[model samples]
Target: MSPYTRPSIAPQVFVDADGQVIDYGHRWSDSPPTEAYSVTVHPERYAPLHAVAAALIDHLRLTYDVEVDEGAHVVADLLVAPSWDVPRAVRVRPRDPKCAALTFVFTAFPGVIVHAGLLHDFPYPLCGCDACDTTWQREADELEEHVFAVVSGNYSESVERRDGEPAAWYQVRFANGSSGGSSSISTVAPERLEAAAVTLPDLPSGWRPWPLRHAAEA
Candidate 1:
């Protein structure tokens, strides 16, 4: 039997602007892939979150033929410390066209860390404030409430690797309208998340967690 229980912060149903958790994320897969993710935002920033997520998903598929899994919740940020050594939290934002999205930013990390300051736009003609600050506080609060709950239950799983290399990874398969073999996935990356950017060849339809293609194989 698997030696783990449900994550306390297990990606719960996405709470909308009205604080209602929607039953959209999560699905059944024949292969039972590993890893799951979601996109969330404060009750007020729902429209912005969805808008940016759509752009990001389209950018991924166009740049790479791979499909993103939509089973994970869509939140405003993935609240994590800027680094293991730092206590200050960082927010990861989705892409948006109406606002000047910060594709990436250099941080105080050892090297040039690409801060997914996706919502770090400033003087928004509409919001009249910096996007990053507004979303950061709300998203960070949400993440703080859930990260420990989820990580406490995060565990490794055995899966068939591309070859017989015995790689450690997980998948969040999609039984929904996804066009790929899997749903959302989280694995080691060749580059850091913020620093990694895929140039799109064509316009995209919506946003979903982009797959980690080069994750270590099992």
Candidate 2:
């Protein structure tokens, strides 16, 4: 069958900043394929980072040809007021009435796009309030520590390819937010990245399940 003839379906996978698979999504190949199954992702569900939402949307579109709605996934800047006290300072989501889940979610890294393993490492920190920070100090520390794993300059220098062409690379963004940029690590050639690890850091995280029909908005 052609690559795009039937929608790509596979086990959902999750990974850490080190690119280690944490949990693989359940799969049922024996089950018959059907279009009736549906899952909804409320924009108001889990507040996510702006950049993360962008990356997720981009990945969905480029990887699966999905479309995100404005109502369900709000694009404008979202403010998590200091006085109000929420985890994130800002959030973004689809503003659409509802977000439908796909029949299956890809949990592994996309062979095409550059996966930001930094989600587990250099993630944008979220703190609801000063009191919460003091109360949940331990939890915050544990979470922040995970992000640190992918921040070093060693991993950022690596590069990867897409569809037989050089596509994306990695780099460390400094705390100062003034220095650093992406670098090429694809010296091994495209075929290598498609089959095995290009960077020495660790294996890239696997993809997870997402809405199949709504994929066009991505």
Candidate 3:
């Protein structure tokens, strides 16, 4: 979004008596301005640095269709902290009260947005019912099994009953080279294992499952 026409504020820079740079930083306003938002640009690297800052604001406006007030300002600042790993922070104020104002802080890397904190307060419906939890758990289990099979190169599976009970338990055997045969077994239960078997896909190499320990075993 186009920023409001406000007076530009120069970032403070500190240097030693020998002309060595000590600190280069900008301080954010303690209170929100009378307008919507503000922009700060670093004095030493204003041109290219402010371009990056302006592009980020434009992205939020175009992508999210957000409105910018005519009186707000944009500040481009220097990386004063020892760590340059800070993410760009954007604060949005929507005119509608029902729509909550949001602050999005995210690291902008090539082809990825890392450590994003966008939807922490976004209004999204969430279900914690047993049925919903069970369904989600089953899907996750199936995904884990598929990854395990691909990594271990073992697709052999079977369902069997113990002590004349229903055949609701299933086991997958993996080939262990040290044993000179397939003997490593992974077990799953509760009848949903059959459904996973039916939907199993032929996996390729280089896929691995996260080491997961069952709570019952714990």
Candidate 4:
């Protein structure tokens, strides 16, 4: 939790005529293998990131017999000031301390190294507009939503995954007994959503588990 008061203003999005975005800043990870969920966010996003960390733990508790790390703040903003030193990153831990960490790097990319197998680097392009933000947010939203779905097998009435196959992927059997699967799953993806969340790999790029094709409100 971020107890420190923060500035009302946030880092503004700037895209030059060439379609390149301004380099706000960069963060370097010692590349530590901390068995936790960590997100490298801009200073402005500290609060929301903190909330998400707690929510993940809560979600896990519902479906699985879970044990979270002993801590007051599961999601912590490294810093959240308004001046020279602001939040460079946020961290979330929702499982056993012995498990591998899942690191999300949502920041500038220069001089950053993400060699750790568990870490994911989301570098903001040098030239981008508001669209980039929307895309990134959408990606984050999809990740969280699908992760929970796959973990709880809640995307459909019942689910079964065939991950041991050459092209690893999961299949969803809807309440109507109709099932669908990924068109192409390059390499081997995680068999369980819990593994997927921790590794956060590039596979299973299009799970398409949203907008409710099974049933829509409208």
Clashes of 3: 11
Top candidate (lDDT): 4
Give per-residue lDDT, candidate 1, residue 8.
24
* Predicted candidate 1 versus true structure: per-residue lDDT over 61-145, tens digit per residue: 3433242333113221332223313212222322332111112111222111112222111111112122222342343333222
Cα miss at 158, model 1 (Å)? 20
**How many clashing residue pairs appear in each of the predictions shown?**
23, 40, 11, 4
**Prediction RMSDs, each to the true structure:** 19.7, 21.1, 23.4, 14.8
Runs in model 2 deviating more than 4 A are: 1-48, 71-127, 134-208, 211-218
- Pick the winner on TM-score between candidates 1 and 2: 2
Which regions of candidate 4 deviate over 4 angstroms?
1-12, 17-55, 58-64, 69-134, 155-165, 172-218
Residue 141 error, candidate 4, Å: 2.3
Off by over 4 Å in 3: 1-15, 21-53, 72-96, 102-218
lDDT ranking of the models: 4, 3, 2, 1
Candidate with more favorable, higher lDDT: 2 or 4: 4
lDDT agreement with native, every candidate: 0.26, 0.28, 0.28, 0.31
- What is the C-alpha local distance difference test score of candidate 4? 0.31
- Candidate number that wins on lDDT, 1 or 2: 2
Q: Give the CA lDDT, 0 to 100, for residue 211 in model 4.
A: 25
lDDT of 3 by residue, 83-125 (tens): 2233344554333322223332222220101111111111010
TM-score of each: 0.19, 0.20, 0.20, 0.30
Q: lDDT: which is higher, 3 or 4?
A: 4
